[model samples]
Target chain A: MKKKLVLYLLFPISFVACDNPAPEKKTEKIHLEKVNSNTDILAENPEIKLVGSRGFSYDFNDERFMQFYDLPVKNLHISIVDDQQHIQRLAMDLPKDKEAVNTLKTQLNKAYGQPGEDAGNDFSAFEEGDVLVWKGKDRLIAMITSKDFATAAKIEKAPKIDILFVKPEETNN
Target chain B: MNKLYTGALLGLAIAASSCGSKKIKIESINNRQQLDSVIALLPKTQVKVDSIPVRVLYMHLKGDFTFYGQPVKEFSIQTKDEQLQACTFDIEKGASDVLQQLENENGTGFKEYSNPILSWSTLPKKIQFSVQDFDGDLLTLSNKEKAAISLYFNNPVNNRITNIYKEIPPVTTTNDYQLEVDNSECGYRLYVNDFLVIDHAGARTLGVTADINPYLVKGKQQKVTVELLPGNDYDGNPRNRLHLESVVHVALKKSSKRSMFSSVVFDFRTPNADSMVREDAHSSRYIRASKFYGQLSAKVDHPFETDAVPYELPCYAAAVTDIRTIPDAKEKILAHYRKLQQAYLEKDSLQLEKLLYPLEKNLQTAWYWSKPIDGQTRWTNIMDKAREARDVKLEENVVLYTTPDGHFAKLLPAVYNKNPAFYLSKEDGFYPLDYYVNIDKNGDVQFAID
Candidate 1:
């Protein structure tokens, strides 16, 4: 009779535990009061500076990459440019920290609304690979966390999160 | 009955939870919709391409080029240069350091060790050497022949690492030869006919195979040699080899053109399990070297001979004007690279293809590849990789490697010799992009295939 009681009591606890895996501990803290305008990204972040310039057309191999000033990210740069040298896209890589990525995602959701489904198998500098996408009236965003299976299978590298932003017109093609 | 029912329910619940949690991640971005409340305030602006000051250059080549491995028909962008360098380019310096260290330890300069005698063995003919018949496992060898096997190293404290060789009955073949070695425990060097074919002294590997036809002569006597060396510490002292275990097997194989398999001509392996003691495995403490000879056939007739014939590549004899003599060559090269970089950023595969065409052809020719290359598809793949590649490093100062006659020049990083000036980092690896080109009389860049 006691064994039956104990087994019955254990069932609910196990079910609850399996159903609700504990929420991840926060690795970073970010507060987003409002959505950031692409035009204001440079003005708001005074430390952000233009690294160099390329011709008007976008080229991945040119001097158009910008350096993020002391950001906690690795390999953070902006590649896209307009004729006026305004940054059209920004790319930055975060260490494979799920909590941090989730935190940022939560902040983006709170500011910009819920993220949309992934769009296509398009080539992304920081935008490529397994990603979560969010679309705006004039902008497109992606959060890449992993590469293709074939490439990832051969290498045992930590997952990287790349956040990218581009103009909606450029993405239409 | 109640407990069994509960247990079964728990199992099902756990299984369901695991499967639910293992949801497949997204593969590519394909769908998205604009949120009603989200702010998007960029003014629509038309982009004008002609207003941009980027200049495009044409690619040309004028030289008899010597390809490294094979040949190709079209232009292709490549990531590595060493693979295309000719066979004569000595890319790896293996085993030389350890041998020099041994020479230094002996307080004497390096000298060739005495070769073991190849006197007539009393063992009857047709009794071949096998793993079971060696010192650890040899079956047909008489006590006299077993005694003749020199399988031990001298004491490392007193004696330097010496070369231990065994004479295999010479065999000739009309096919390409491959040297295969499996060394799990220690560093080793394998030789064919006294020619250093493999010097594997870095990280230990289970097996490695290399083309040995370049080292072997047809219709001539061939020999296989193995030299084992102790690893060194950061301070150059011989590393402790206590409790280490090693098994080495070296073989020469003849590959056929029509078939997928190759036959082993001769092979040498370590002693059997019974003979390997804990102390015997220690190279720092062992006082004797292990030696054994294979009873391989003196001659084996290969069924196919057409594979033996070498393919001769067409070498360019005439050379064009040197790129350095061209006016503002460096500036043009830098401009050309920047334009290419922009092409990548813009995802303009057509422009990228135009710039990379000559180099792709040269690479194809150098590699002896005859398949038709799809430039659009190749560039698309490159662009996709570039999209994912992060932490890009670029430099203005580039080192130019020109042809002997200065007809063409390729660019690499000035400080780093291995890769090009621009490389994209992913994890700990890098993707280097480099180009070789010639400047025409019209002051335009001609992509070179030579």
Candidate 2:
């Protein structure tokens, strides 16, 4: 009887568990969907694909991001995530002079403060015609590519991809 | 075991959260304090930010009075912005308050109050006060009154008092030599014939003397008039502020004529001996001698024969002799011809004429050459023709005659030889001798015979 009782209890418990169907592990899929959607949005707007950070994917149509790109900036990008989040994507369109790339790096450092230990070590040279990618915030991504790097060996050899995570103003405190 | 482990993990998580929250709270308070201190240091004069008491003292004294028997009350304190802040006092509240406080502290007579004292001092981080004693009495008020007296502290901390004293200029006169009457603290207007010469403005304390040269013309007296246009009486009392004790009447005499001639003789001595010799020989001796001889001879005979007489003859005889009837007439004629030769040699007529007679034919020839040709031949034809002929000359005997020294007569050939066109007009007279003689309408000779 006890065995039957145990079996019955186990059967109902299993049935209940089966009925629930182990909440589909949608975390990775949800994050993937968010990244895909953001990528689509970014692709639609050239300015967004140019400024993506590591783990965090951003909406290309954000008004603040648009305002930032509209500013008189050269080799400019939005780094949504940094080395802290492990995913890094750099997007940039640089001017002809290597000095311009250096200047952009310096400005980024000053604006975002120094890169922390998690930020993917130091910036590396961008491959020929390859868009640079960097890590930024959680699920935030950064990408940079420069048209000027094509002909400029020095600039193309070591193009600076500034990766930064920008937190929402409300979240900064 | 799993439950216990989960519970312990949760507890640790809670403790960590609390620690983080506490640290954030403490950090926030520290930041707030630092920000407050920074705001305080900033230069903020806005009334809302800070309020400081500003005490202004005003003293109104009746008439000019003496403080401690010394002439005072004229002194005024002017703010840096030229605002009149304070003046002397009669029944001064601020002075009385300070004096009473001092007296109460130091019983009765305060030795330092002998003189009418005006002094100021600042309390450390507290207040600044100024004291003025009218009766030279310091100890008069009680301690309670002293403490209650509203002391004027340095509000702006940069307040500066510029003492302004009355500036009474001496009496002045107008350019037209008239007395200038200025009876107002404000300056006067100086005018000549009612035309404004100078607009003296904002001159206080009256009677400012000015030395001005208006360039008035001599012999004519200008009516210099001055109208006293009063300035703004800053004291609010205009009565007796500007007193014209007397209008000074001064006459400016016209500058005397300056002499052109220098009292000291200027040395014009020629540096070159050669130049000196040339001027002395050519200008002084020969020219003067030739002039003398020509005048003397012109008085006696016709132009043609006057020069035939020898230069060695007595002065009167050489001047009066008739060469037409002279003894040794042939010799004189030869001598006259030789003079022409000598003229060519010396290049001087004055010298030649003194030694020989003037050739009548030569004079006639010169006279004919002096006439102007037709229009087409005016310049080139006449002058060119005259220059080519050696003997061709002007009919002016004064020009033709030479001195015995051969110096002065040298200039004549140069004149006639230069441009015949100039002398070849009817407008030019025939006898060049007429130029030398100072003959008036009466025909009386005024030649220098000596």
Candidate 3:
């Protein structure tokens, strides 16, 4: 009788084990907030925030292109003018942190692809201020400004940037 | 009696095992069918975001479908809070009917539905349905309903970014331009038309003057075509290697009333061959002594007059009928000349080869040798010997002139000579007097005689 009972118990146990399998492990979920208030987002991620209030405006005669990201704020300003007489003005808000600067550089590299490949790193982050100036074709001028106000104030402004034609071999196009 | 008891026991055991196994099998099948129905309704569907029709379906059903080598018909799930959020599903015939039945059960909250029958003819063989929420209701359907039903799902609402350009009326200003390019393996042929013209290749950039100039007639809406051929193996992939930075084509309504003289000024400098020779031979003692003596005598006499005169007679234009080197001689001296000719024809030289080659060769040879007694210096003597051997050939009366009206003109002898200078005038019948008069009187002239 004990043997029969043991056999019956074994069979039922095996059936139950096979019937109920372990449940799947779940993933942690994150709730995303809207990016409507730039200031609010900037406050939360201050490391990636733009340091200054003044940002450059770009107007391309060919409106087909809407916005370009990560372009050296300087190069994007001069590519538009057709005449030597017109003047161009540009400004940029630099990132405060090293990570942000690196990300910005990467983004600009991707955006400019060939044209920006040979462009030297003209940007610098110092204790006081940061500013860049350059002359482009046809009297077009480019300027870059960053807040980290103290850093900007401390920086020694570079001489006016002259438009240099990159040799054919050096150009990415 | 023992046999009968054993048989009875065996029969009972077999019946029990059979009953247990059948029940488990049925339960497992039922569980699977339920899961499949849930999967069929998992895809998110709302509004189409793109003009192009795109749909994605996920599901888990019993069959031969596998992804990334896993036995899954569909398995996509994400949870928020403690709620069991199931946003993915698997759909087969039976499972789809069950889902529809659930939709009907919760008519108020769960209003979404999908086609019960899967149409394999569509590009993607599945349709997806999604409900805002599920309220712990077990979906069920009859065997017959399951047999006729198939699961379908719809894709989630897509939110891909697209570029949109604001409409701007085409400007008709004379400043607008277009560049028509014939890009070939060897180089590019650029045609500039419209407002602004820019021809940039290699390191050189050439722009057309907007103001009406003699070489370019303004207001006429002139078309300038430039052929940029690759430099001799200066780099690789000559054709695709060149880039166009920008182009402008302009049509001036009234050609700028600029005088031809003001638009084009002739700047000529008579290269002092004697000075050049002296400078090049400065390192040599023989050259220094000769140059010192020559300068002293030149100051006493009219150095310009003596230096200008040729000891040998100038090679007449009549000496050779053709001014071209023979094909055989092309390999000898014509190699460098051919390069210069090419640069002149192209009208752009970034390598400065056109300016450097002839001057460099002359300077090198002049400094390296001592003065010869027979008017045969090392470099000059080589040319003399080459001419005798017929290795260097030249043609006579070969007229050289720039066109659109001869802006410049020269005559070459058929035979090579150390001093190869010759002149012509209206009186000579063979020369065009009108063209000569058009050139500025101050234009330089140097004669080399053989």
Candidate 4:
């Protein structure tokens, strides 16, 4: 049990560290308040509460990757412009349980609103790796993911919400 | 991860690089124990240095040696530039102060080692050698790559904290701007394309230089991107290995101050910050594993049944002539590949003897130095411990992808398992044979890995 736990916990940290790009600045830390959902934590804490090391993007190696699930579920990742720390893209992964997912959907809908026309009815969420996607004035969001069997096999249980935020230029708009 | 899987993964990197070797010579040392201690400790590249091959540059002993390998009473190393430096392991974690006391004695000019983890004097000669080599082809390099390589060589101070590297865009001159680069640490970098641009250790921290002025994009006053790195006493800080104290971006400024991409400064770190004492800079892990684990694993691997593997030989193949295209190109090429495989399976000395490429011959001489695999029977032994390959098992399904000229054919390996005989790890241990079989229309095995 102990070994398994160690492997499970350390695997993500080590595996991610092997490839993950360390943030450029001294990673400022804030203690995680005893909160239930990540939405509550985001609402309560004004500063960014980073849990573990950041993973870089394998696609367009810009490190446009931000991983949130550090120790376990209820995680978020955000890529920012290196100098300004401006949000280039943001993603979050939550619990996949129906109730937990519903709570997340409610929080997300209230916070960032619905998908625009370009996204059409499908939102591209969980279809080709991303579950639900949304567009904001200045950011792009990706939530939940279930791509091909080869890629999806890596994740045990798909998260409730996985979101990404990118600049308007990266979007169809 | 299973040990087999891990070993297979490390095998790919290890096997491919198993060809290069270095020699170490120690001069007369009075202290036997000191010599032993230095031999045991120094020059061995540690796992944390990303497990890359490290050659011993120099180890000069000045009579005084280790006090029984127990945190030397006094240890000092001087660089070629005549900068004297004294180092000790971290002092906070119950580390003995014997060295500290010894440092103060006789104005030994020793002080508490800065950067508790890694402390060294002057610039790294290894980095210096690489920089020297880069200077050879300065003119040939594209302007962008040339600038990045130049910046890396110029910024000697960055080596003290983090290695400076060029962020190569796939296609250069994409736009007339300096490309971004990741400042975070990663495993063994023979080249810099492995990292990303703009991804430094963290946000708001990076320095960039460009050959072209940025004002060309937007005239006069453009707020040139100046990143400011973090400042902290990173003593005992695990992440300090990743970030440079600061990296400067010396840009190509226009004659008068009116040019865009103007110079800017963000002093988040102290200038001339002392070099680090990398705990992983040595190669001990490589020594033990390469010498022991690699051989043992290879010897213990199950003998693969390569004999029964079904394959086809095309009759239409031959060697690639400078001008005339051959008649039976595919058949001739396939026959050559089949012959190579048959040579390996049947242990045929004659055919195998004729199949070595000039590069493969050089590889044999370089890799297997003491008793190079030049003999007929030695070919099997060579294949058994293939440095660039593990146990290559072929499946029945063979596809002969022909060349456009119909003079050559590529025999793609249907399936193969990378059972590395002498590698460290194998997470993704599947290489469908990296052999490039190129035969001419007349059926000559001309050139390639085959």
**Candidate 3, residues A1-173: lDDT per residue as tens digits?**
55644443343333222323323322111111111111132223322212221111222111111122321221112211232112222222232334444454454345333122113433332212333323222221122333553355453332222233233343222
DockQ of each: 0.01, 0.00, 0.02, 0.01
Backbone clashes under 3 angstroms, per model: 56, 58, 44, 78
> What digit string (tens of lDDT, one per residue) describes model 1 on residues B187-283?
5556554444455544346559876553343334555666554433233344345114344566666543222224556665654242433544544
TM-score of 4: 0.24
lDDT at position B102, candidate 1: 22
Give the DockQ of candidate 1. 0.01
lDDT of 2 by residue, B1-450 (tens): 333333333433344354442111100111112222222222343112122234432322222322222222222221222222222223233445444333333222212222333232222011122333322122333222211122222211111110000111112211112222333233344544333334443434343333222212222343445444333344633322333211112122211011101111111110112211245544632211111111111111101111111112112222232332334433433333344444434445344233222222122121222221211122222223333334423323212232222111111232222232112222233212211111123322222110
Give per-residue CA lDDT, model 2, range A45-161, as digits (tens). Answer: 322222233224322211112212222222333333222222233333333355565565455455444433323423434333334332234322333445665465655333433
lDDT of 4 by residue, B1-450 (tens): 344333333432243244331111111111222223333334343211212223312233332222212222222232222221221111111122322222222112111111111111222111110111132221122212211000001112221011101111122111222323322121111101111112122322334432222112112222333232332222322232223333222222221111111122222211223444444657222111111111111111111111121111121223345222555554555555556555555654455455643324322222222121123223434443343342334444455544334433444434321231112122346433324445444445553422
Best by TM-score: 1
> Using lDDT as the measure, what is the rank order of every candidate, best first?
1, 4, 2, 3
**Which CAPRI category fits model 1?**
incorrect
lDDT of 4 at A78: 36
Q: Which candidate wins on lDDT?
A: 1
RMSD (Cα, Å) of model 1: 37.3
lDDT, candidate 4, A21-83, per-residue tens: 322332223222121212222223322233322222201111112223321242334333343
